[model samples]
Target: MTSDTPARRRARVFSRRRSAPSRARRRLGAAVRMIAALALAGGVYTAFTPGAFAEDNVQLSAAAQEGKALFDNSCISCHGRDGQGVEERGPSLIGVGSASVEFQVSTGRMPMTRQEAQAEQKTPQFDETQTKQLAQYIQELGGGPELPEGELVEDLKTNPDALARGGELFRINCTSCHGFGGGGGALSSGKFAPSLHDATQEQIYAAMLTGPQNMPVFGDNQLTPDEKREIITYITVQLQDDRDPGGLFNLGRYGPSTEGMAIFLVGIVLLVFTSLWIAGKS
Candidate 1:
């Protein structure tokens, strides 16, 4: 074989070095492609698999289940299976929450005596625990408004502005039927929207949730829970601050009509008595 030229040998060595780098680059690209493929596979697998981060199921207690069964059997005729109520028979129990259930059941207004214009309070059919279970059963059936934990009544002192806001809300919503000063009003039927003067915060809340008798339901969608609390505060504060100057018993704050009647009857009797005293002295 003839001896190789210096230029030719140098050219061959440079080509070999360039080819080695090209081979290494190809291997590196293949490795990156494989890694990407593996990552995509992992993502697909996770998405298809069940129970990855599933929500926990709500569990009912035995009593609640039993109550639900009883409700279905006895009450569902009027109340509906879902407790949304029938059109003419019963009102929706959805979002009325536990407080209303307790009040209605404990007072024996529920499991009604008959379909009447109003349900009168009487001896309770269910005990406290049973009442609570029934309430829970209704609550779980169709989620609606619920009472907050701890005390049912919240202190209005926490937010003074709530009272002001509540008054405005009351005027807009309740004043039409309950009157401007919480004096109850007559309804279409013999039913009346009872005075708020004697109602507590919880009672007011329950009334709003339950819609009691002829009153229309104010669901959370219509009036939020916070707004309900504010309304209660406004009513309570008004009742507490209303001090009568005449030392006369105010008949549920019926305003001018009752006041005028009282003055006419009592003032006439007093005037007659004074005239009799003058004649006796002469």
Candidate 2:
């Protein structure tokens, strides 16, 4: 017959409180032990597999070595130590390839002055030789789509059949973004489809190969080498010709948009002047 004494109840409550703390301590200790074990396992795995994760010691060619130095000096802040890319700054260049580098550097679209919606074409920071070196470093880091050798548009010049094929291809694949006359157009974001009138053959080829920015990659599976060359010919030769059948001024060649704007402005001016002349005659 145990009586319900206040002291007895107090003692039981105190014991329960003590047990809870002990249980919590045990759980915390177990968690610490598990974390320590995981850390040890990771260290051991990394130590045993040196070459599997790191390429720091891999020997580089002379050009690649120079490129490395250039990258570290000018590009490391954005591109990261091994061209892995910096967070919220640049993208990983691992598989972007030399052609991409050539296009970006040659067009002066990189070594960006500031982070914007897109990199715009400007005066190049590196010369042709230096650009190649930077590209070589990226290529050696991880091989990617390479630039085609020799003249890309030469063969298409002699073949009228191929030139026609190129025009059709451009209309199908590029006109949606670049506009019918290649004057370029606005995109969803701050980015824009640049005017192809200024783009060179190499730049066009690289743009298609790497699919810079919004452009999709046109690999061999999509557009064959011969097909690529033909497209380049259509843009550089036919589109660039100063002799427009319609008139001297191309009016930006932006299809209906440019023409509409021009007509609206010119019409407004004429209407204002015509009203003024009628008032004076009256």
Candidate 3:
């Protein structure tokens, strides 16, 4: 074997040095690829995050924003910041829908005095426009059934059978608490059925749809929209605006009890007159 020389050793050292750099280069390339994969994974996770999904879903309209301001001012105390409501103080406004808000606020039945069996109607805290704004806010918080725009009652002027149909519906469904004349009546508790005299078509329709207070929900499944409007026409046009036809006394329109009283009084009066006339003639 040839004796080792500085030149040969130096050549071997040079080869080793070159090979070291190549190995380092391969390690660096692997590190770079690993870092790039991590970054891509992070980006994909963020794109699919729940927070991102929520942000996309939270878009609100201008009317809803205006109503939000009003809700924050007046309704936040009981309803909470997001209208989820305060336990024992108020119920959730989210998912209650605009129809519920309109029925309660428009009819002056909300911002209640105290929790009871039912809420009573008073002068509304907000006017018509403000009430609608509040409804908009509540509607956007969590979606639910909405009132149909435009006239609540369909045109029934030409329908001769509309009044009769309405009266029949009212008697079958409404006469239990509301009297036959639409006068208010007492309920099981201190609560009472309110008079329909002052109720507008919108209020009536909203009440039926939302079932405000102790009232039961009469959804579209229970009463079709046409049937609801028919019921309203009967309440507003026929019952509220009845006339004394045939020139007979209506006797307060309380039906058989009032009629029996009137008959009894007239019979007594006639008998007394006849007896007095016979005595004088004899």
Candidate 4:
């Protein structure tokens, strides 16, 4: 009986030893599950955070809404509640695009004090932020040609053949109104093509895209991005910033028209002087 008891105790010990690894594995698995639950809870909390969700949803459409408000307050009289325009107050802006709004507002040619033949550039009623908001409103209201986004000036400087290509394109297309040197020239009525002297790259690009006032719209189809950049390079670098290298005169950068007028006047004066000299000698 004593020997049998010892054998039973040995058997019991062996069974416990065999089950120890299984118990340890179960404990480890439970710990892993608890850790996974904690991580999942944390992820859920972060995703539902008020600030994060608000920032994601609210800011995305804020600009356009604010722009709509601005349009309602100041522009409703001229542009109408639906942006359809009111007779002589304003023209329809259904498809004018954000470029037109930005150019007109940023340049302060809008929110006119009085209706005239043309809107003149003046001190802006709204700052740049407000102007952009207005542009966003106009953009959302109606779809039209959009100015290319991002840094337009940087690309013009980097392009190697910009100057050459721009010169040719400018002479062919721009000389009639802008002059050969971008000095600007007369148009019908009191309207005139503005000079490119002080115009920034953005303004120039906007002008081309929107065709403010009587200027014809040169959309992306008419002038591709590369062509527009080339034209801007020529206008800014060669025409606006030219030092007129060598001893030759620039003649106001007006090309042959002004030179021809000056030559004709000079010739007339010389002929009169020669006639007097001949009479005196005779």
Candidate 3 worst ten-residue window by lDDT: 49-58
Worst 10 residues of 2 by lDDT: 241-250
* TM-score of each predicted structure versus truth: 0.58, 0.74, 0.70, 0.68
Candidate 4 local lDDT, 22-99, one digit each (tens): 999999999999999999999999986532221213332578788878888899899886577789788877778888
- Candidate 4, overall lDDT? 0.79
Estimate, for each residue in 56-117, the C-alpha lDDT of model 1 and write its tens digit.
35466787687787678778888875676788888777666676787678667788869776
What overall lDDT goes with each candidate model?
0.75, 0.86, 0.80, 0.79
TM-score of model 4 relative to the true fold? Answer: 0.68
lDDT of 2 at 223: 95
TM-score-based ranking: 2, 3, 4, 1
Better of 1 and 3 by lDDT: 3
For model 3, name the residue pairs that clash. Answer: none
Model 3's lDDT to the true fold?
0.80
Those runs of model 4 whose alpha carbons end farther than 4 Å from true positions after fitting are 1-60, 158-160, 243-251, 256-282
Cα lDDT for residue 109, model 1? 75
Candidate 2 at residue 198, lDDT?
85
Candidate No. with top TM-score:
2
